[model samples]
Target: MYAMPNNDLEEATPWLDSGEQQVWRRWLVATAQLYRYLDEGLRPHGIDLAEYDVLVHLSEAEDHRLRMGELAGQVHLSRSRLTHTVSRMESQGVVLRRTASHDRRGVVAVLTDEGMALIESVAAHHVRAVRRAFIDAIGRKDLMVIDRSMAAVIAATDPASGPPDH
Candidate 1:
Protein backbone atom coordinates (compact mmCIF):
# COMPACT_ATOMS: atom_id res chain seq x y z
CA MET A 1 0.00 0.00 0.00
CA TYR A 2 1.19 3.53 -0.81
CA ALA A 3 1.51 5.85 2.12
CA MET A 4 0.33 9.44 1.92
CA PRO A 5 3.14 11.95 2.19
CA ASN A 6 3.29 13.37 5.69
CA ASN A 7 5.35 16.46 4.97
CA ASP A 8 3.43 19.65 5.63
CA LEU A 9 4.51 21.07 2.26
CA GLU A 10 3.10 18.02 0.47
CA GLU A 11 0.03 17.47 2.60
CA ALA A 12 -2.07 19.80 0.45
CA THR A 13 -1.70 17.45 -2.49
CA PRO A 14 -4.19 14.64 -2.40
CA TRP A 15 -2.81 11.12 -2.27
CA LEU A 16 -4.52 7.93 -3.35
CA ASP A 17 -6.66 6.20 -0.75
CA SER A 18 -6.01 2.47 -0.18
CA GLY A 19 -8.74 1.48 -2.62
CA GLU A 20 -7.40 3.86 -5.25
CA GLN A 21 -3.85 2.58 -4.73
CA GLN A 22 -4.96 -1.02 -5.17
CA VAL A 23 -6.84 -0.13 -8.33
CA TRP A 24 -3.86 1.80 -9.67
CA ARG A 25 -1.46 -1.08 -9.08
CA ARG A 26 -3.81 -3.57 -10.67
CA TRP A 27 -4.25 -1.34 -13.71
CA LEU A 28 -0.51 -1.17 -14.21
CA VAL A 29 -0.02 -4.91 -13.92
CA ALA A 30 -3.03 -5.69 -16.08
CA THR A 31 -1.82 -3.46 -18.88
CA ALA A 32 1.64 -4.98 -18.72
CA GLN A 33 0.34 -8.52 -18.74
CA LEU A 34 -2.09 -7.73 -21.54
CA TYR A 35 0.74 -6.31 -23.63
CA ARG A 36 2.83 -9.42 -23.02
CA TYR A 37 -0.08 -11.69 -23.87
CA LEU A 38 -0.73 -9.91 -27.15
CA ASP A 39 2.95 -9.91 -28.08
CA GLU A 40 3.21 -13.61 -27.33
CA GLY A 41 0.29 -14.29 -29.67
CA LEU A 42 2.20 -12.53 -32.45
CA ARG A 43 5.41 -14.47 -31.77
CA PRO A 44 4.72 -17.18 -34.36
CA HIS A 45 4.69 -14.53 -37.09
CA GLY A 46 8.21 -13.38 -36.09
CA ILE A 47 6.99 -9.87 -35.26
CA ASP A 48 6.51 -8.24 -31.88
CA LEU A 49 3.80 -5.78 -30.89
CA ALA A 50 5.63 -2.79 -32.36
CA GLU A 51 6.11 -4.38 -35.77
CA TYR A 52 2.53 -5.58 -35.80
CA ASP A 53 1.46 -2.03 -34.99
CA VAL A 54 3.37 -0.67 -37.96
CA LEU A 55 1.79 -3.21 -40.29
CA VAL A 56 -1.68 -2.39 -39.00
CA HIS A 57 -1.18 1.35 -39.56
CA LEU A 58 0.25 0.88 -43.03
CA SER A 59 -2.54 -1.52 -43.95
CA GLU A 60 -5.12 1.11 -43.00
CA ALA A 61 -3.43 4.04 -44.70
CA GLU A 62 -4.32 5.37 -48.11
CA ASP A 63 -2.65 3.17 -50.73
CA HIS A 64 -1.10 1.31 -47.80
CA ARG A 65 1.44 4.07 -47.32
CA LEU A 66 2.23 6.78 -44.76
CA ARG A 67 4.96 9.33 -44.32
CA MET A 68 7.63 8.06 -41.96
CA GLY A 69 7.02 10.77 -39.36
CA GLU A 70 3.27 10.20 -39.42
CA LEU A 71 3.73 6.48 -39.05
CA ALA A 72 6.24 6.88 -36.24
CA GLY A 73 3.78 8.98 -34.26
CA GLN A 74 0.91 6.59 -34.95
CA VAL A 75 2.94 3.59 -33.88
CA HIS A 76 4.44 5.50 -30.92
CA LEU A 77 7.94 4.75 -32.11
CA SER A 78 10.75 7.28 -32.40
CA ARG A 79 11.57 8.20 -36.01
CA SER A 80 14.98 6.52 -35.83
CA ARG A 81 13.45 3.45 -34.21
CA LEU A 82 10.74 3.22 -36.83
CA THR A 83 13.42 3.59 -39.52
CA HIS A 84 15.33 0.67 -38.05
CA THR A 85 12.21 -1.49 -37.76
CA VAL A 86 11.22 -0.64 -41.33
CA SER A 87 14.72 -1.55 -42.48
CA ARG A 88 14.29 -5.01 -40.97
CA MET A 89 10.84 -5.35 -42.52
CA GLU A 90 12.23 -4.24 -45.89
CA SER A 91 14.79 -6.99 -45.74
CA GLN A 92 11.95 -9.45 -45.16
CA GLY A 93 10.01 -8.01 -48.14
CA VAL A 94 7.22 -6.88 -45.86
CA VAL A 95 7.62 -3.13 -46.44
CA LEU A 96 9.38 -0.62 -48.62
CA ARG A 97 10.55 2.93 -48.06
CA ARG A 98 10.33 5.54 -50.75
CA THR A 99 10.59 9.30 -51.19
CA ALA A 100 7.26 11.01 -50.73
CA SER A 101 5.93 12.25 -54.09
CA HIS A 102 4.61 15.45 -52.54
CA ASP A 103 7.82 16.17 -50.67
CA ARG A 104 11.15 15.14 -52.08
CA ARG A 105 12.80 14.98 -48.67
CA GLY A 106 10.00 13.16 -46.81
CA VAL A 107 10.16 9.38 -46.57
CA VAL A 108 7.11 7.18 -46.86
CA ALA A 109 6.58 3.62 -45.64
CA VAL A 110 4.53 1.32 -47.83
CA LEU A 111 3.17 -2.12 -47.08
CA THR A 112 4.16 -4.83 -49.53
CA ASP A 113 1.86 -7.54 -50.89
CA GLU A 114 3.56 -9.95 -48.54
CA GLY A 115 2.83 -7.65 -45.62
CA MET A 116 -0.85 -7.50 -46.58
CA ALA A 117 -1.02 -11.26 -46.80
CA LEU A 118 0.64 -11.60 -43.44
CA ILE A 119 -1.73 -9.21 -41.71
CA GLU A 120 -4.69 -10.89 -43.36
CA SER A 121 -3.55 -14.24 -42.02
CA VAL A 122 -2.57 -13.00 -38.56
CA ALA A 123 -5.40 -10.53 -37.89
CA ALA A 124 -7.87 -13.18 -36.70
CA HIS A 125 -5.34 -14.51 -34.25
CA HIS A 126 -4.73 -10.99 -32.96
CA VAL A 127 -8.44 -10.33 -32.62
CA ARG A 128 -8.94 -13.51 -30.67
CA ALA A 129 -6.05 -12.61 -28.40
CA VAL A 130 -7.51 -9.19 -27.82
CA ARG A 131 -10.88 -10.66 -26.97
CA ARG A 132 -9.41 -13.22 -24.63
CA ALA A 133 -7.17 -10.74 -22.84
CA PHE A 134 -9.37 -7.66 -22.67
CA ILE A 135 -12.86 -7.46 -24.10
CA ASP A 136 -14.30 -10.70 -22.78
CA ALA A 137 -12.54 -10.17 -19.49
CA ILE A 138 -14.25 -6.80 -19.11
CA GLY A 139 -17.61 -7.97 -20.51
CA ARG A 140 -20.15 -5.95 -22.53
CA LYS A 141 -21.67 -4.00 -19.67
CA ASP A 142 -18.31 -2.55 -18.60
CA LEU A 143 -17.04 -1.82 -22.11
CA MET A 144 -18.55 1.63 -22.14
CA VAL A 145 -17.03 2.37 -18.75
CA ILE A 146 -13.57 1.49 -19.98
CA ASP A 147 -14.17 3.42 -23.21
CA ARG A 148 -15.11 6.55 -21.33
CA SER A 149 -12.29 6.19 -18.84
CA MET A 150 -9.69 5.77 -21.58
CA ALA A 151 -11.15 8.59 -23.62
CA ALA A 152 -10.84 10.88 -20.63
CA VAL A 153 -7.24 9.79 -20.14
CA ILE A 154 -6.47 10.48 -23.81
CA ALA A 155 -8.19 13.85 -23.78
CA ALA A 156 -6.25 14.90 -20.71
CA THR A 157 -2.84 13.69 -21.80
CA ASP A 158 -2.62 13.14 -25.55
CA PRO A 159 -0.58 15.79 -27.31
CA ALA A 160 -2.86 15.73 -30.33
CA SER A 161 -5.77 16.65 -28.08
CA GLY A 162 -4.03 19.94 -27.17
CA PRO A 163 -4.18 19.24 -23.46
CA PRO A 164 -1.16 20.32 -21.45
CA ASP A 165 0.66 17.41 -19.85
CA HIS A 166 0.88 17.45 -16.08
Candidate 2:
Protein backbone atom coordinates (compact mmCIF):
# COMPACT_ATOMS: atom_id res chain seq x y z
CA MET A 1 0.00 0.00 0.00
CA TYR A 2 1.14 3.50 -0.75
CA ALA A 3 1.58 5.53 2.43
CA MET A 4 1.40 9.26 2.84
CA PRO A 5 4.63 10.88 3.87
CA ASN A 6 4.89 12.19 7.41
CA ASN A 7 5.43 15.90 7.12
CA ASP A 8 5.21 16.76 10.78
CA LEU A 9 7.34 19.40 12.48
CA GLU A 10 8.96 16.54 14.42
CA GLU A 11 9.78 13.00 13.42
CA ALA A 12 7.74 11.47 16.25
CA THR A 13 4.51 13.38 15.82
CA PRO A 14 2.32 13.95 12.75
CA TRP A 15 0.42 17.14 12.25
CA LEU A 16 -1.45 18.78 9.39
CA ASP A 17 0.29 21.61 7.64
CA SER A 18 -1.40 24.96 7.10
CA GLY A 19 -2.68 23.97 3.64
CA GLU A 20 -3.97 20.66 4.89
CA GLN A 21 -5.62 22.38 7.86
CA GLN A 22 -7.39 24.76 5.51
CA VAL A 23 -8.68 21.86 3.40
CA TRP A 24 -9.93 20.00 6.48
CA ARG A 25 -11.71 23.05 7.84
CA ARG A 26 -13.33 23.85 4.53
CA TRP A 27 -14.53 20.24 4.12
CA LEU A 28 -16.15 20.34 7.57
CA VAL A 29 -17.87 23.67 6.86
CA ALA A 30 -19.09 22.59 3.45
CA THR A 31 -20.45 19.28 4.72
CA ALA A 32 -22.39 21.02 7.50
CA GLN A 33 -23.77 23.67 5.18
CA LEU A 34 -24.83 21.13 2.54
CA TYR A 35 -26.62 18.93 5.07
CA ARG A 36 -28.42 21.91 6.57
CA TYR A 37 -29.45 23.13 3.17
CA LEU A 38 -30.87 19.77 2.16
CA ASP A 39 -32.64 19.25 5.50
CA GLU A 40 -34.21 22.70 5.37
CA GLY A 41 -35.41 22.10 1.83
CA LEU A 42 -37.27 18.99 3.03
CA ARG A 43 -38.79 20.71 6.04
CA PRO A 44 -41.82 21.92 4.10
CA HIS A 45 -42.52 18.30 3.21
CA GLY A 46 -42.53 17.35 6.92
CA ILE A 47 -39.39 15.23 6.69
CA ASP A 48 -35.75 15.84 7.52
CA LEU A 49 -32.83 14.65 5.39
CA ALA A 50 -32.33 11.52 7.51
CA GLU A 51 -35.95 10.51 7.27
CA TYR A 52 -35.95 11.22 3.57
CA ASP A 53 -32.89 9.01 3.17
CA VAL A 54 -34.61 6.15 4.94
CA LEU A 55 -37.70 6.49 2.84
CA VAL A 56 -35.69 6.54 -0.36
CA HIS A 57 -33.84 3.35 0.55
CA LEU A 58 -37.01 1.55 1.55
CA SER A 59 -38.83 2.65 -1.56
CA GLU A 60 -36.09 1.26 -3.78
CA ALA A 61 -35.79 -2.07 -2.01
CA GLU A 62 -37.55 -5.28 -3.02
CA ASP A 63 -41.22 -5.16 -2.03
CA HIS A 64 -40.36 -1.69 -0.72
CA ARG A 65 -38.77 -3.25 2.30
CA LEU A 66 -35.39 -4.12 3.83
CA ARG A 67 -34.11 -5.90 6.89
CA MET A 68 -33.80 -3.38 9.69
CA GLY A 69 -30.05 -3.90 10.01
CA GLU A 70 -29.53 -3.58 6.29
CA LEU A 71 -31.66 -0.47 6.16
CA ALA A 72 -29.73 1.07 9.04
CA GLY A 73 -26.44 0.51 7.20
CA GLN A 74 -27.82 1.94 3.97
CA VAL A 75 -29.11 5.02 5.77
CA HIS A 76 -25.92 5.34 7.87
CA LEU A 77 -27.83 5.15 11.11
CA SER A 78 -27.18 2.94 14.12
CA ARG A 79 -29.54 0.07 14.86
CA SER A 80 -30.93 1.87 17.92
CA ARG A 81 -31.21 5.12 16.04
CA LEU A 82 -32.97 3.44 13.15
CA THR A 83 -35.36 1.83 15.58
CA HIS A 84 -36.36 5.19 16.99
CA THR A 85 -36.60 6.81 13.57
CA VAL A 86 -38.63 3.89 12.19
CA SER A 87 -40.95 4.11 15.19
CA ARG A 88 -41.52 7.79 14.51
CA MET A 89 -42.06 7.17 10.80
CA GLU A 90 -44.45 4.34 11.66
CA SER A 91 -46.49 6.65 13.81
CA GLN A 92 -46.55 9.14 10.95
CA GLY A 93 -47.84 6.36 8.62
CA VAL A 94 -44.75 6.48 6.45
CA VAL A 95 -43.26 3.09 7.35
CA LEU A 96 -44.18 -0.24 8.85
CA ARG A 97 -42.00 -2.76 10.68
CA ARG A 98 -42.69 -6.44 11.00
CA THR A 99 -40.80 -9.62 11.69
CA ALA A 100 -38.94 -10.86 8.65
CA SER A 101 -40.79 -13.72 6.97
CA HIS A 102 -37.64 -15.83 6.56
CA ASP A 103 -36.10 -14.99 9.88
CA ARG A 104 -38.51 -14.65 12.73
CA ARG A 105 -35.83 -12.98 14.86
CA GLY A 106 -35.09 -10.33 12.22
CA VAL A 107 -37.11 -7.16 11.75
CA VAL A 108 -37.85 -5.47 8.45
CA ALA A 109 -38.71 -1.92 7.57
CA VAL A 110 -41.25 -1.49 4.80
CA LEU A 111 -42.26 1.67 3.04
CA THR A 112 -45.97 2.30 3.03
CA ASP A 113 -47.84 3.75 0.08
CA GLU A 114 -47.82 6.97 2.08
CA GLY A 115 -44.02 6.86 2.32
CA MET A 116 -43.62 6.22 -1.39
CA ALA A 117 -46.02 9.06 -2.14
CA LEU A 118 -44.19 11.36 0.23
CA ILE A 119 -40.78 10.70 -1.33
CA GLU A 120 -42.20 11.06 -4.83
CA SER A 121 -43.61 14.43 -3.81
CA VAL A 122 -40.32 15.78 -2.46
CA ALA A 123 -37.73 14.15 -4.75
CA ALA A 124 -37.76 16.88 -7.35
CA HIS A 125 -37.44 19.64 -4.78
CA HIS A 126 -34.70 17.71 -3.04
CA VAL A 127 -32.80 17.33 -6.31
CA ARG A 128 -33.09 21.06 -6.92
CA ALA A 129 -31.79 21.77 -3.44
CA VAL A 130 -28.88 19.37 -3.99
CA ARG A 131 -28.05 21.03 -7.28
CA ARG A 132 -28.31 24.50 -5.85
CA ALA A 133 -26.30 23.75 -2.77
CA PHE A 134 -23.69 21.34 -4.11
CA ILE A 135 -23.64 20.10 -7.71
CA ASP A 136 -24.10 23.42 -9.47
CA ALA A 137 -22.03 25.20 -6.89
CA ILE A 138 -19.11 22.81 -7.45
CA GLY A 139 -19.43 22.49 -11.22
CA ARG A 140 -19.13 19.26 -13.19
CA LYS A 141 -15.36 18.71 -13.14
CA ASP A 142 -14.99 19.50 -9.46
CA LEU A 143 -17.96 17.30 -8.62
CA MET A 144 -16.30 14.40 -10.40
CA VAL A 145 -13.15 14.93 -8.40
CA ILE A 146 -15.20 15.13 -5.22
CA ASP A 147 -16.96 11.90 -6.06
CA ARG A 148 -13.70 10.04 -6.60
CA SER A 149 -12.18 11.55 -3.47
CA MET A 150 -15.15 10.50 -1.36
CA ALA A 151 -15.04 7.00 -2.77
CA ALA A 152 -11.38 6.73 -1.84
CA VAL A 153 -12.16 7.87 1.67
CA ILE A 154 -14.92 5.31 2.02
CA ALA A 155 -12.69 2.52 0.77
CA ALA A 156 -9.90 3.47 3.12
CA THR A 157 -12.22 3.60 6.10
CA ASP A 158 -14.23 0.47 5.34
CA PRO A 159 -14.64 -1.67 8.46
CA ALA A 160 -13.90 -4.86 6.57
CA SER A 161 -10.52 -3.50 5.52
CA GLY A 162 -9.33 -3.26 9.10
CA PRO A 163 -6.88 -0.54 10.17
CA PRO A 164 -4.07 0.79 8.05
CA ASP A 165 -0.63 -0.64 8.75
CA HIS A 166 0.74 2.77 9.63
Which candidate's TM-score is highest?
1
Q: Each candidate: what lDDT?
A: 0.92, 0.91
lDDT tens string, model 2, 1-166? 2246566634554557778888989999999988998998898999999999999999889899999999999999999998999999999999999999999999999999999999999999999988888889999999999999999999999999998756
Write down the TM-score of every candidate.
0.91, 0.91
**Candidate 1 lDDT over residue span 1-166, tens digit each:** 4465688856776678889989899999999999999999999998889899999999999999999999999999999999999999999899999999999999999999999998999999999999988999999989999999999987778777785633
Question: In candidate 1, which residue pairs get closer than 3 Å at backbone N, Cα or C atoms, i.e. clash?
Answer: none
